[model samples]
Target: MADHHHLHRSTKNRNGFYVKMKFFRTKNGKPEKPFFVKHFKWILWFSLSFYFFAKFLNNHESSTNNNSLKTSIINHSHRALSESILQKPKTSHGLLNDLKVYIYELPSKYNTDWLSNDRCRNHLFASEVAIHRALTKSDFRTFDPMEADFFFVPVYVSCNFSTVNGFPAIGHARALLSSAVELISSELPFWKRSNGSDHVFVASHDYGACFHAMEDRAIADGIPEFMKNSIILQTFGVKYNHPCQNVEHIVIPPYISPEKVQSTLLKSPIDGQRDIFVFFRGKMEVHPKNVSGRFYSKRVRTEILRKYGNDRRFYLKRHRFAGYQSEIVRSVFCLCPLGWAPWSPRLVESVALGCVPVIIADGIRLPFESAVPWSEISLTVREADVAKLGGVLDYVAATNLSAIQRNLWDRKLRQSLLFHDDVESGDATWQVLVALSRKLGRSHRRLRVSSE
Candidate 1:
């Protein structure tokens, strides 16, 4: 019995020794016998346990390193993807380079005789795109649809949304995609929704009367399709409307600076500051009949000038700068009046020039926060209250010129809301545009296939 037990123990020790030799065998050496045969039982058990533990640790280290390598490769690949895809010609020129897009700029009938109030007359004062092209030094090539990376649809305010058939139905769709109060939810009908990505409707509220009304219709008609197959909705407005979470207010490129404009006009003394009071810096021509509330100009401008001209109590000198910044710096205040509703390019330029802007329009939605106090920065004048106009101007003249000048340059509201010449709004806009472009491209390919 004792010999039987001894044999079993010997057999177990021999197997353990064989395993250890198999693992540790060197290229130049033979298998070595157990160093301590007396403690063979304890050593065999310990060696077997140690072998498995060591193997587990090696495997764990190798696995950790492989996973880290895989993660690094994935990160590097994603970083290169945007740059590579953007290099494709399809998405160049403010359009996503890798995307296949077709932009059709819908020309308005008002463009033909934009200067004449008879034909181009609308509730708005300014002429349409054709007029803008003639007046401003904008490139006519921008409207060439063949050269466009994405279809450009110029949306305007019409009294009846459906009655206005501005664009041809064969290739393009009317812009009914406004991101306003009426359009902000998931619970909406399908007909109003834009189904494919091929068409992107930029719901901009830059124009005064058209903003709220057009966007209300667009949201009601669009939210449903946006849920299924989304189209890009680029909104640029001061007021935040429906589905504020999804809508991205694209920054409008700042207008040419007074210095650059002066250079273009070839005026001398470009650096010289012009301080002229109450400059009528916008488009002068207007249709008399369509003038309503904010759209109508109440001859309060003439009244203020005429009143100040005769007033001896305060030596108020009233003068017009002919929309020229050269003479604008001559006056302490730049009287910026809104035409019908609340938007005018003069307000933006006035602030940029470090002049105190006096807003005369009643319903003009103030852009800056009420807390930081724009009263410290600008003057807000009521449209009809000609009585308070003098008081407001007097108050502006009383404030410290250095503080006001400093506020204009260092102002957070002005910086955040307004666009500067150096900063490009293209990147954020491009991100949204790319997503929509891909969506539209996929839709176009799918439609082609289905039709086939």
Candidate 2:
């Protein structure tokens, strides 16, 4: 019985040992799926989350860099544009830098044929040549009207007036002016651009004021109806009373022949003692029945002749073309009386010869008043003050008179009153061009603001 019990115990012990060995093998071999298989879905979720987060960070950095680059480019462009705007206007020959003018091509009958006529080749035709030459020689002319700052109408009103049978054919002149204006308005896009504001017309004739002929009144009234809105470059820019008076219109100097100008310029400057105190040469009386009638009949000339004809201090002579410059050079002051018009070539001639001009014309508008101070250079007398002419001049201090003479000899002032071979900065033609440029720039600025 003892032997049987001991064998049973041994068997139990073997079974226990086998059971422990099997448990150790299963634990060691399988490894429990590395502790992740128990929560496999959670592991996959964490891995995918990490990958997407990393990708989003990379894209954000790239976008920030691109935005910064775009901002830098925009800022640079704005700065460049601002600098360009603030820069000074470019200058060429000291006038308008890049200003362009386009001259309208009209039929010869309108301008060329009449201007080329021998009778019209005097002072009446001078402006046409000088203006054309200046514009052509300078860099300001453009063949295309679209590129031009000003549209120049080269019709010579004075030349056209000469074409008619009678000298002062008010009806015929008006018709011709109206026709030219109508043709340009109808055919070109430029005239209608600024309602003819940018278009320039020359009417330097003494009868320019008569462009608007009133059949009943028999005189020019204001400006021609068609030209009221246009820029009229005229000699008849009278201030208060007479027609063709406009602030918008430019008053131009009369055309003195280059030959006459050269000869007068060659003379020595006025020095020491000039013999005559004042000089007058021209028609002392006019026919009562002239076209302008009482308007042309300036009694001031006759009154002066009557008052000072015998006075040794005041030299008075009937109209004589010869030795005119010699007489002017001999005089201290030249009398510029109103004749047919308020403006005369004599005023310019006196200025050329450095003689102090005693202006007696009523309502006269001097040229280049902006650049040249006429009041400082010349003496003005009223039409009613004819008897006090001597007293008026005598009242001026000798120091003041000497100063006026000195100012007349100034290179700049003399050049401003005349035309040059090349269109210079302060010359009459250049001054007109500068005025036109300013007008155009203002118009352009207005357009830009309206568009914005």
| After superposition, candidate 2 runs with Cα above 4 Å error | 1-97, 160-171, 207-209, 212-222, 241-243, 267-273, 286-297, 397-399, 441-452
Q: Please report how far candidate 2 places residue 302 from its true position, in Å.
A: 1.4
CA lDDT, every model vs. true structure:
0.41, 0.67
- 1-452, model 1: which lDDT tens digit per residue? 87545644563687655555554554456544444754798989998998687667656655676433233233334433544567542223443343333322222331232334332222222222222232122121122222233333333322222335441121112333332212322222221333333333433233322233233343444433342333334322344443322432232322334233334225433224544544544433333223333323455555455555455332243343444654444445666664433455556556645556777766444542322356776777776775576676666567676677667654343334332222222322233343444444344444554688
State in Å the error of residue 384, model 1: 3.7
> How many clashes in each structure?
23, 0
Per-residue alpha-carbon lDDT of model 2 for 48-145, expressed as tens digits?
A: 99867755765565467543323323443453355557864334533464677766666667666765555454553367556765775565665545
Per-prediction TM-score? 0.41, 0.71
Off by over 4 Å in 1: 1-278, 281-295, 298-306, 309-323, 366-376, 411-452
Lowest summed lDDT over 10 consecutive residues: which window, candidate 1? 134-143
Model 2 backbone overlap count: 0
